[model samples]
Target: MDTFKKVTAIRGMNDVLPQASGRWERLEQHVRDWLRSYGYANLRTPVLEHTRLFTRGIGEVTDIVEKEMYTFTDALNGESLTLRPEFTAGTVRAAIEHNLLYDAPRRVYALGPVFRHERPQRGRYRQFHQVSVEALGFAGPDVDAEQILMLARLWKILGLKDIRLELNSLGAGEERAAHRAALIAYLEQHKDILDEDGLRRMYANPLRVLDTKNPALQEMAAGAPRLLDFLGEASRAHLDGVRARLDDAGIAYTINPRLVRGLDYYNLTVFEWVTDRLGAQGTVCGGGRYDGLIELVGGKPAPAVGFAIGMERLLDLWEQSKDEVVGQAVDVYVLHQGDAAARRALQLGEQLRDAGLDVIVHAGAASFKSQMKRADASRAAYAVILGDDELARGVASVKCLGDGSQQAVGFDALAGTLVDALSADGDAGMPEPSAAPPV
Candidate 1:
């Protein structure tokens, strides 16, 4: 006999259990619906792309490119391929390859898993999911404000609190270079305090040193040259325009000069929606204008602004505060006892499903009491009892799970009856069954 060995999922990577996947599904649907309402079309891109895409798009000196990407070479071609660390680069690559911006701007959204070789924590994971929203070809501050306001709507929809917005303007390339030179000059004098990592990147990408988590460098990093002061006339005006619109909409924000995004392509407006609930991974969503990304990724020069929310972070926050979303609950649970009833139950399931109802027919014959238990556990609004008597009469006893009321409905009436009961109970979120979640 062959010996077997135990295997486990890769560390930092995780499996979303069946019980917990409901919240993910609900949150995804909620965000998708909200994005669609704003005329954003769904965009799907490949998970693996040319390695240079991220290194060039996100930046060479960045942590993601330097230490976190899952990159490997193709055996036959010798070309480097990388599972995406973030979706923006892939999204932009797709836009360029597909010529999506040939005529006009496209408001697009994508949700998928991104791989990052990082230590797993409470809200951070090696393989994580993110929902990225991108607005391409729009150059005005109006679009920038719209993206921020859209996030506010998301928080409101998810019933999230304690999340606040922080904004900054990285200025244009010229202004950033000016600030970079000054920053390098100051850091040259403070060499003693520079950590090994900071010393290495002092000249290559000095701005990222400001983003360090090192307690020893926090005060010193804070006092580093502020990019906000280096904003040229155009950069300052662009930021002011965004702020004015935000002020008009009553969306409050703080301008943190040190809030340079971790990506290289970002320029002009940048923002992060942060919360205290998610431990050190406080940022739930972060994005800003990446006007140079399109050009860098071989597309015609175009302006773009968007953001991505970590699914893990969002799930954590939702569980802590807004755990009110209805999840994975069917509108009807069809219970059956014998072979004959099981056959009828399957037929009833199809009928209810065709009539636009969420039904989970009890599979594999079990005791009536056991089936009822399963029905209740399903959190279904109704438990459909298919006993011998009801089967012979071509009727099903539909018990309202929320209440104790029970009634007999004919096979033809079961779908409508369940629908009415679900409607009466205000369980409209469960309409037809959705596609299986990515558990």
Candidate 2:
């Protein structure tokens, strides 16, 4: 028999370190709070779905399905299943399976990891995090405008100020059919100049050929048919209304005729948020209307609009602004000299916590100098010292670590003194311990 070696995580997977998770949690809290204020409820679907879901929902021509999908045969029943490449497909599957389409439009949001098999780069990964919103059974351009504006609000909540929005129109089914013909004809004229990927896109999805970022292909495709020219009267009016609403809300945007999202289901108005701070894959959020996807997935013909923000990409942007990401500050670290002192320290820790202060108790016994080093490393502003000498007098030394100033306080006054010392004014950069840190 051959011996087998233990295996670790496969390539393209990564463990989030403490500093990164702190930033992620801050971003998540901001997103959740904003979603709550906008009446978007949380929804969670399974990580794995029937393989056919992506095949039909994301479109088989897309790279996510043809190459990047992690599909397998289940051992239990031999059914084909795959880890989700995106959230929208699984959300739609759950909505149809659970009968969430009966009464009114469903406004739901989700945040979790999505899997894909691809070469990982600076901001791209095989296992990545995503935050998405799905608005089902809504058809008007007003709903489309609301979804776009909601996403902008989320970016504001993250304290991301330098961002740009790109908007486009894919028109309805019949209108798209006509546009597809004109687009293909243009690509055929430039067939010899096309690269391999561009050639594949031309046949697989002529619309995606317009979205290609290849400098040569982009130059060639510049004279191709623009979707804006082919938009039917309804789609034209709808897109105009969307832009008008955005302008009314003081949202800035650029109208790009070539902004067709990769997914096949999206139709009518489509938009993306980009930041020049991120190179290459600059789009942090992308979404559009999919009026016929519900019926394609076995639900009724329900119109919907949604978007997914690449959390990993957003965090990358946050890393560039870490100095602004407010980290947790330790209110106090109790330094005890002995067992009895440690007990008294624990008592004081509990008291401070009850009075709404963040307190981390010292573990085990160590020299006073060593304990001071630990307290300084914690970024804790205050250190409570209870030694044998101080315990004998029924008092503790309260030292402000920021300035090394020491004052003696009675045991009964420890909690109140600490709370008053760390109280945050509205303008203070320090965040309340109970609230999540900023990103």
Candidate 3:
């Protein structure tokens, strides 16, 4: 019998090692903290969905459906299934399937992997993570403004710098239809000037011509009529209101007319957060209003708006900037010595826990030297050591790892000592906790 070839993770897929888990946890924690403060509850959806959901929802003309979707037929039923290319489509699908629209105007968020079979590059992967926030069943420009503002708050929380928000109004149906007609006529005139993709995009999605990377086409696109000029009074007012609110909130932005987002469902208030620091594909976050999304996904028409930030891209930025993430709660690391000392250390750990401190104790398995090494790697400020001698004397060694200062105290006072050491500087070197070990 022929042996099957040894399997490996598909190209563009990579394992995140234990050393990098801390960074991922930091990234998610940063996002979740802001989301909680803003009152958005978490919502999770499966990784696979009916393939046609994306085709109808993501727009067949867009590159995602045109080329990049990871589609396959379900083995059991032969239904065409796909690994989601992006979040909004599946999010809307889930909302509709669950009858979430009845709860009209729910603020929901999700963080998970989205798969797209595209040529991968630095910061771009076949399987990537996204944090998306959706506000469903609200139809006002205020909803749009809130969405953008919340995204701004999230960026601030991430401590990302030099990130610029690019805002655009895709306008309501009639107004966008008018803009598309004008854009089509313009693109048709310069049809010969476009490359194959641009030319195809012209007929399929002429507005996308404005997003072309082709230098010549881009030059011609510069002089085309701006979509904002064709906006109906309502869209224009909505756009103005969003801008005004952003200004009042002290968030900076630029209005770019060409930013008709790549999805078909988006309508009005499209935006992207970009930075020059990330090469080429610099859009770290993008989202917009999708009023018809619920209806398109087979539910009642619910006006929804949201944004999704690429976690990989976000982590890239945070690593580069060395931004501070809040909620570093690991306050103490307890090091146990011999057999009985491990039991005493565990008791002390519980005492510290009862004092409302975050405590971690070394598993009794590791050697004392190994435990110290783990403590150092954990970046714990206070390493409480309980050896055989200290245990017999009814005392413990609380060593401040930073200054190498050791204090021997009664075992009963161990919790207070740890708390005092932690409370001294508050934020000084509150090292992030390590990721949970693999099972």
In candidate 3, where is summed lDDT lowest over 10 consecutive residues?
A: 430-439
Cα lDDT of model 2 by residue, 1-439, tens digit? 9989998887888898765576778889888888888888999999999999999998988879989999999999999999999999899988899889888889999899999998998779999999988899899999999988888887766667678999998887787778888888889999998888779888779887777767877787778888788877888999999999999999999998888865556788898999888887788888899987898999988899999998889987776755677565568989999888999999989988999888889999799999999898877878999999888887778887766777777777777766767774322332223322122
lDDT of 1 by residue, 100-154 (tens): 9999999998898999999898888899999999999999999999999888998
User: What C-alpha lDDT do the candidate models reach, one value each?
Assistant: 0.87, 0.84, 0.81
Highest-scoring model, TM-score: 1
Off by over 4 Å in 3: 1-8, 262-264, 323-330, 343-370, 426-439
Model 3: pairs clashing at backbone N, Cα or C within 3 Å: none
| Per-candidate clashes, comma-separated | 0, 0, 0
lDDT tens per residue, model 3, 1-439: 9999999989998898866877798778878888888778898888988899989998888888988999998889899999988888888888888888775578999899998888899879999998988888888878788878887777677576888999999888887778788888988898778889888888678778788887877779898888888888888888888888898889899888888775556787998889999898799888888887888878888789998888889988988877453334367789986789888878888888899987789985888789988887777777888888787777777777777777676766666666666776755542322222122
TM-score of 3: 0.88
Off by over 4 Å in 1: 262-264, 323-328, 426-439
Model 1 residue 298 CA deviation (Å) reads 1.2
Specify the highest-lDDT model's number.
1
Error of 2 at 91 (Å): 1.4
